[model samples]
Target: MSKHLLCLALCFFSLKTQAQQSDFSNINFTKADAIANKYKGATLESLPILSYNLTSTLKTDVEKFRAIYRWVCANIENDYYAYLKNKKTRNKLKKDSLKLATWNAYFTQKTFKRLLKEQKTVCTGYAYLIKELANLAEIKCEILDGYGRTADVNIEELSIPNHSWNAVQLNNKWYLCDATWSSGIYDLNHYSFKYDYNDGYFLTDPNLFVKNHYPVNTKWLLTDTIIPITSFLNGPIVYPTTFKQAIVPTQPVTLHLEVKQNQEVIFLLKEGNPMDTSNITIEMTSGTYKTSVKPTINKNSDELLEVKHTFDKRGFYDFHIKLKEEYLITYTVKVEKK
Candidate 1:
């Protein structure tokens, strides 16, 4: 082989190797395994069972909501002995039994297994376990790294670095709930088993949370409204649908789709007919245009085709495309009022 050709081949191989190495750094499966391992050998406790009457009354939404509530209630206990046991092992201990800071630290590092085996953890550990359980139940929850203020002292401002809690979204609203404060010692024996589902903690006014807990994502503290996942998915795509928009007099709107590769796509329209037999027009953007034309409008039963050139002149217009038989995808674009 020529000397120049050998250099070119070596360069190509180096580039290939670099690309492969970069892909591995993007994933962190090891961290997840480490977390799981920390809780190994922990005894599995039977979760609290919902009341028979409550179970019968639960509908789809109610059932999902109740499942999460019951899981938290069943797994955590309010035993003072458990707290004392955990306090001895963990460091940076707080002398005050009611200190929220102590609770957060214990929960964050400990696992459910630790809680079951040792019967105690700090506040952070409790919050972490709660977050994990909420995730398992398919609920969206996040831990807020912030300080808490009690009536007695402004420990947070004193740089005491106290407290941790969770903000959960339910029915499109963010609610604050502090299981630690609620479950902490109460009566003489510190054996009070009553679980308080305090509304004071739920859908808390932002002003209140800001005074005590400065969340990492301040947006979570701004409103009770739970941001929908669809809002994020509705943003721009690499290959968005192209269409003509107008406003004066109602007229039929046409969308032109361009497919660069040979792939099957579920063609959809937000405001145009996907199944109009007589009024719709379909044409290939590329390739042998005539051969690529679809005969009769193919529409899925779940999809409907309707026209609204006048009503909705603003907002996004989305369409689906299936590329080759393997890839199903969609693209979207915005239309301004004319």
Candidate 2:
């Protein structure tokens, strides 16, 4: 059989086996039933026939396939990675090889149900499972091979094909989703599962993946715009002050400021107590005056407050602000220098 035909056969066979093994008695098929009921007028009796008999199904088509696919994705747990990583539980998965070579070899011998029952498989195994489920739901999906880069690391430097994920067609548009990435994995250094789901990476903009992910087949990327890692890492710098000059009277001007991305600021005066709130307030003629301000923390913090004052008298004020944190944040303007 042709490769495409073989893949299709595997997909259908997996679905048939999964349906037979699935314990639907425990599942509240009410939703699925309700979805199926929409086609009550149709003559189809079974799911497979209804799914493949496009002419009849499309007649009552309420897009139940997408619903079923989403439900499965939401319900399935990606625990293989975590299970293999734990020393105590890792032994159980010993039968299931972690090596990519072993996984590639298994796909040739095992069907989806067998691999799933073994509770061990590699990236290809996971992708195959996804394909199986998608096929059952009649959702068009494809497995794409690629390398995933750590947040700051570059994939181009890596020598091995380290990751795999899925591309799903929804609403006539393809999106990338990584179930493995969705599952929190233990970072050896942190010793805890860092559970962060970046939907942006799931079904991402083809342009954005080019800079980080080098798919075996570039066609899967689907976009020409290459977004640099720096573009995502280095964001716009929001200066504390948007204005270089402001009109103020010497009485005592209070400047209220906030920073975005939750950054903290430390206000310093060249001639006043750094901690003294009163000293931070200065009186000058009706003109602009310059004061120096700096941030203390190197990371963004929650919303905070900092107050600066100039008396009713103002002159040309020159103030300098230095970012103490290396994150992008926004500040709110509470007080006006004018």
Candidate 3:
């Protein structure tokens, strides 16, 4: 498969979600959230009624959409086993287009059954349900298939599309969101679903959204920045908290890096808010042995933070940054003796 080119139409949707600027601040979601909480355990028998119950009393398009989005995130569970199976099959059949297409077609049916009956699904099911509910409410929403980059995704092995999200048109403007990421996280240690609602994925900023999500269709890219597939793949692995905290990694554009002993590597970020530098910590792991470091954090300004860490030893290491004990982003580095 050829590399998917990305041309984000940044100019067209700048005001919609530029950097840290959000148009949703003034819009109160109390009513919509309350409604979602009230209807916490809704079934999927009738989408129209679900949509109506979620939106009829809501005042605005965004609020209406929020109610539906929140309800789905809270009620539905991410099928981790199914997700693993789909990923394995997709990777195995990636080289054969015919077989891959056939498998996708067959699995889609099973996915729907699991979603409707058990309230469990993967990314595709989440996107489908969102689109169906939005369509029932006469809201403009679409399912977008593309690559979703997490720490586990090997860029070299990315062939078939591995994820799906949603694009919404509200008030004559386009917005992007991923209910799958927002719903919760899969506990890797225990191998179970953890219900942690992250609202950052709701109508996310295109600039930050492009960090991990690349839609198959260029038109869905609301930002105008031209990001190549290589850059998208090489970028650092960002977690949901990265978006929630409005922290964008500006330096070390690539995740993998090489440096000599005693060489210094700089980490830069554009913060959405003035964060306490003391709350940040960098942990480096080389194989089973792990160690933590307190890098010198300097504020370029209220919104720009810089971190400097020098490699004193030679090894292949994985670096993780945490803010207030929440994971923000990760990078891999190789240090060699001079």
Candidate 4:
């Protein structure tokens, strides 16, 4: 979702492990929800229905793709409670077949159909469904098999892919999209899905998507520049809205960021242009504690600024890169207890 100037090695995210399903039948999607019906999911039998109802308002190929994607995100929920029995009804059926498959599972047509009828899926199911719908719409799409920064996935754990996204060729330009993430995340604790519709994943910038998703076929990255997996793990977590301008991080942004309690962490910023000094300001805010710091800047030329700070507490602190008081982008830092 973002970009940066210097390529520093530091990435952090967390995810819950595979959870066991439980009773969640009492929970109901609101009646006004588009995907409230059991058959609202994408399926072979529903293709004509979906094509007619969803794409009827669309006039262009791009609109068709967006319509399909919007429909999926609105109606689909990660199948968190599929296996769990509805305690009210004595009938227990295995209608959902999404069993935490590894990176190797092929997105066969059969499995994709099952995901649609059942109304749930992981990353792979999302990829397959999008591809299927895209093909039906005559839009060129590919299932981008890749290694995702799946909740706490470290560099060592990235040997195999843990996720799959989609790439669509629109107007001869290929763009990245993650239907699973766009739809919502699987909440293991609540044993349900959080309906958070995200549009950033659709037609995303390859550089930003590269922060977390590493495609097995690098071509699917759909960018002229590619960042390595190691760099991705070390680089700051970014999103598109995080930056106002394109911040390309090549190297040498940080000397060493190993900060200890009561000690300062030296921070550096290298801008491509030096004359924009009046516009840029770097600040820190602790979301956990609500404390803010505007570090004293050691301006080096118009392009570089060196700053240092000591965080008062150990928690998730956010680094904001701003232009004239407007936050353009952010980098997250984890200050731990000594």
TM-score against truth, every candidate? 0.38, 0.40, 0.89, 0.59
Candidate number that wins on TM-score, 1 or 2? 2
Ranking 1 against 2 by lDDT, winner: 1
Q: lDDT of all predictions, in order shown?
A: 0.40, 0.39, 0.85, 0.56
What TM-score does structure 4 among the candidates reach? 0.59
Candidate 2, 157-194: lDDT as tens digits: 44244467777665444555555554334466855445
Model 1 C-alpha lDDT per residue in residues 1-338, reported as the tens digit of each score: 99999988764443222111112234433433333333333333532222222223334322443334334433455545555564443334554645556565545445455665654544565566556665555567777765554433342123244456776655434456555654433466655555543323333344333434444454554533432323222222211111111001111122222332322334333332122244333222222322122323343464433221221233443443322221122233344444
Query: By lDDT, is 2 or 4 better?
Result: 4
Give the Å shift of residue 87 in candidate 3.
2.0
Off by over 4 Å in 4: 1-44, 80-113, 238-256, 259-338
A best-first ranking of the candidates according to their lDDT comes to 3, 4, 1, 2
lDDT of 1 at 187: 61
Please give the lDDT score at residue 222 for candidate 1. Answer: 51
| Per-residue lDDT of candidate 3, residues 1-338 (tens digit) | 33332223443553244422267778999999999999989899888888999999988889999999999999999999999999899889988889999999999999999999989999999999999999888898999999888777745345568889998877767789999999999999998999999887888877678788887876676776666778778888898889888778878888888999999988998786456879899998987979887889887765468888999989999989888778898898999998
Q: For candidate 4, lDDT tens digit of each residue in 1-338?
A: 23542222111110011111011124332331332232354554666666566555555656667777777776766654432222111122123234323212443444455575766666667777788878777788888877776324634344444577887765545667887777766678876788877655666556556766888876566455555667766665443333223343333332123445576755555432233545556676654554445666675565546555676566666666566665544556666678
Residue range with the least summed lDDT across 10 consecutive positions in model 1:
240-249
Which candidate has the highest lDDT of all?
A: 3
